[model samples]
Target: MSGIRDAAAILAERLHAFRSLGDNCEFGFVQRYGGVEPSGLLRFSYTPLEDLIRGLRCGFSDFGVPGDLRLSVSAGGTYYCHSVAYNIWANTGHSAGSIAPEALLEREYGRLAHLKGKFLEDLADGTKILVRKTGRDDPESDFARLAEAVWAHGPSTLLRVTEAGPGWVPEPARRVADRLIAGTVRRFAPAEQAWEVDLEPWMHLVDGAYALARGAAPARLDADAFPEVLPLPGRLRRHVGRHREPALSAYTRAVDPAAVRGDAVHVFSSWVWIPEDFAGTRIFAAAGYARLGWRDADLSRRGCWQRVWAAGRLRPEAAREPVGLGMIGTRRDAFWSVGARFAEGPIPGEGPAPALRMPPARFPGRDLLGRLVPRFA
Candidate 1:
């Protein structure tokens, strides 16, 4: 048998032994087959005996294969577990009807076993150290390398041996697995900075490493020795301000008229003033050209007028120049019929005499008109 096939056979044997002990295990395989022309791929995601319908549809979406793919999933114990298998064929012209999922699994299982064995052997020789040397300048990259080493060589090794069988596997496998797991947990866990970046992968490796280590040397495993690394406190603090509401009372109290006159308060708007009550106050009304933080405009040039409800009149105030209160909703609909009043007479060098082109009739309303007309009552 080829090296890949031989390794797969070993893995299968180990898996069989694992199942014999009542430990639940699921197996999956993905295969691709085709020719020079446009080909088709079929996938079967099955577990032990049950085939999952939903999983098959999802497999189709995930692979993006033209031909139909099949998937199945099952549980070995009370809790349902997942095992997936996939196959792809290009121009073979053979329908997937003939291939059995189990046969494909058996074939691929051998290849996986061989690959894993080779990986373990390279791991044993400290290949990780060589990889780390290639990018020593980047701290994040260096830490990832260290973390991968711990996972591949340390605890994961022990867990594999223990799961396989205590006495069934060679003494060397058990010893190696144990030493790697224990050493990694003891050394790496306490290093706070190392635990910070890409923690998911590190944790995965750590768990597998720990399991393998304990399996190899059950007596040597110190349950309490594992160090606990907590997340950084500063990271949480940064996000608190984003979700908090601003203090309205404090903001309203801070608005100063003198500051506005001095060009300090460039932006204007009721929203920027904080307290909604100050929306139409004299300070806001007189400073028509004042900048309101929310809206975009030069407040110094264009003044604002209001439609007074008490007098039922549209009162137009030209603060410095005869400013046109542009049509309310649309520029074409001009509401210029209301008489326009200026705060001061025309200054020298002023361009044109300010004009108020009012609408045909006075604004509609008794109470609103009352505010504009001088009160006789």
Candidate 2:
């Protein structure tokens, strides 16, 4: 079986979640076999399992994916716990998925034999350093690497384009997801949410040239095989070409075509990079594009801090400082929140995952940006 299907079969059965009063099957904790204890309850959906699988395999950020995602611990055969996406983020909402430390180590049902985990939480917790950031760099931050990966792969979670819809109609779902997530920032983000990029991919480059670096191949994405740029309507292409530089014009060719249409309204929404390395400091962050961080004009400007955030949590241990935009999220946050080895967002009860967004793209600067922003961008 594919790595994802193997994980789904295991955790989907063990998770504990809460089901709202909707017209669907009930979902929560489930009892196990062979006298095994019950896996704790969680709130998640098993539908669109494909999206969840892509999220686990590629480390697709919640924002980049069209639908939202929930990671729940799934284990099979007594050893190894896999963090799998339990729900697809769509118009309805997402599930509350988390596991306790004690439950993950159970002898018969939860012992992780020789399995090496690779979920977002694992990377955040620093297990899969190579996969998380790949020690790569871009002008702004490693997140650029991740963004490139997400856009290139076009995982089902974030690729919602329909065959016949207007070039960009499929984009509304993403904007809606962002609005739902913004309200839950402080509650979920790490008390110490921060990362340093003084000299990355380069530092690694220098290190690679030194010891232990000989024979080691550099980590990178294939520049030539990026997914085909989504087709843009003729008018939209001209509109983008008129305002953006050649580089941006080339870049927008790859962005969700609908988001860039001149007539379409959009908000560059929620972004989190969980697997980033902060070295030794804690920071709290929320994705934003208001007056505080990068203005919409900078969207075309690469390598600059775009998704900035107001820093620090209410907790004193969590340092207070401005959070520059980059891929943000990690196991450290989950370590404090759920005591689990890894997790995507904060544990369900700790805080809601707010659908954050970059400020709406400002063309001429209109008052109705608040309403029109989510639709295009």
Candidate 3:
């Protein structure tokens, strides 16, 4: 019986490793095992898509939750690309709120038009519908097109639009753009919010839209007033000094491997709470980082692992791999790292820290909101 228990432990470690490798490659960074800091809430503008993807991946990988992974990427000159892990788990369940490609596009376009009209009306007078197109051509047209694509296409298109020169948008238009870029709004009701529509889905849509229109995403909206917040940070910090053993133990008890299908398991941490139905019997794990202004009680910390594993286990093939382990949270303000112990080897001693890479370059003329910097010429 002791030998059997040992074997189970070995199997869990191996499975976690396998899943971790796959996740790291896809997003260019590991999910869990990082730290965070308090850099003003407005810092979301300075964050790059690559950094956000890496941070989110690390967070989910650590917690060991389960589900599909989705991200919005930028493409063409004025388009943003949206991607998702395509599989049964992501598609078949009641899991979260999802907008069809057409619906997402229409909703975003309507919002843009509404906001634009408001800004214009507040500034000058006559502002009417001009034209709206969706595609990747006619770079100089007065009315540019924006196309929304999905990552299921293996680099699918998301938002494709043409660039309109200054002549098309006069001085009044400039002020309107400034106001639209700075504006923000929120919804609170029912005393309780659903994770699908109220949180994750809204985050993805709003962030993607901001990326396309403003060149930056919105920082997380505060929900402190809500009850039962996920991933209490204080609980997470306590688990850390003990090398995550206590947290792992609690999670193991919460999960039942017998209920989980497939020979392998994966884990991740995230900022959103995952429903128990998604875990089944899989051995899930969680980790926390301190960067990105995530406190010990931040839901993103707990939600990280849930998000990554959920994405990986969407297919039986992915679930059959060497098993997986991940962590999420904020990286220390300056550096990033990942640590693991294989089933057959001794854990290595601590070493020099890894350097965080510089964020991607912003286009010279583009503002944080993705608008072109005004050029008199």
Best by TM-score: 3
Give the best candidate by lDDT. 3
lDDT of each: 0.22, 0.22, 0.23
Per-residue lDDT value at 377 in model 3: 16
In terms of lDDT, which candidate is stronger, 1 or 3?
Answer: 3
Global CA lDDT of candidate 1, please? 0.22
Ranking by lDDT: 3, 1, 2
Model 2 Cα lDDT, one tens digit per residue, 292-330: 111122223321122212211122222231212222123
TM-score of each: 0.16, 0.18, 0.19
Sorted on TM-score, highest at the top, how do the candidates line up? 3, 2, 1
Residue 374 miss distance in model 2 (angstroms): 26
Q: Compute the lDDT for candidate 3.
A: 0.23
Best of the two (2, 3) by TM-score: 3
Residues 1-377 of candidate 3: C-alpha lDDT, one tens digit per residue: 24323322232222221111111111111111111111111111222233333433333222112222232322211222122221101111111235454454444344433533442232232111111212234342311111111111122122221223222221111112321211111221121111111112212222333343444433322221111112222221111111222222232122222334323222223222322222212232322111111112223232122222221121343312222232232121111112221121111111222222222224224558974232221
Q: What is the Å distance of residue 150 in model 1 from its true position? A: 14
Worst ten in a row by lDDT for model 1: 27-36
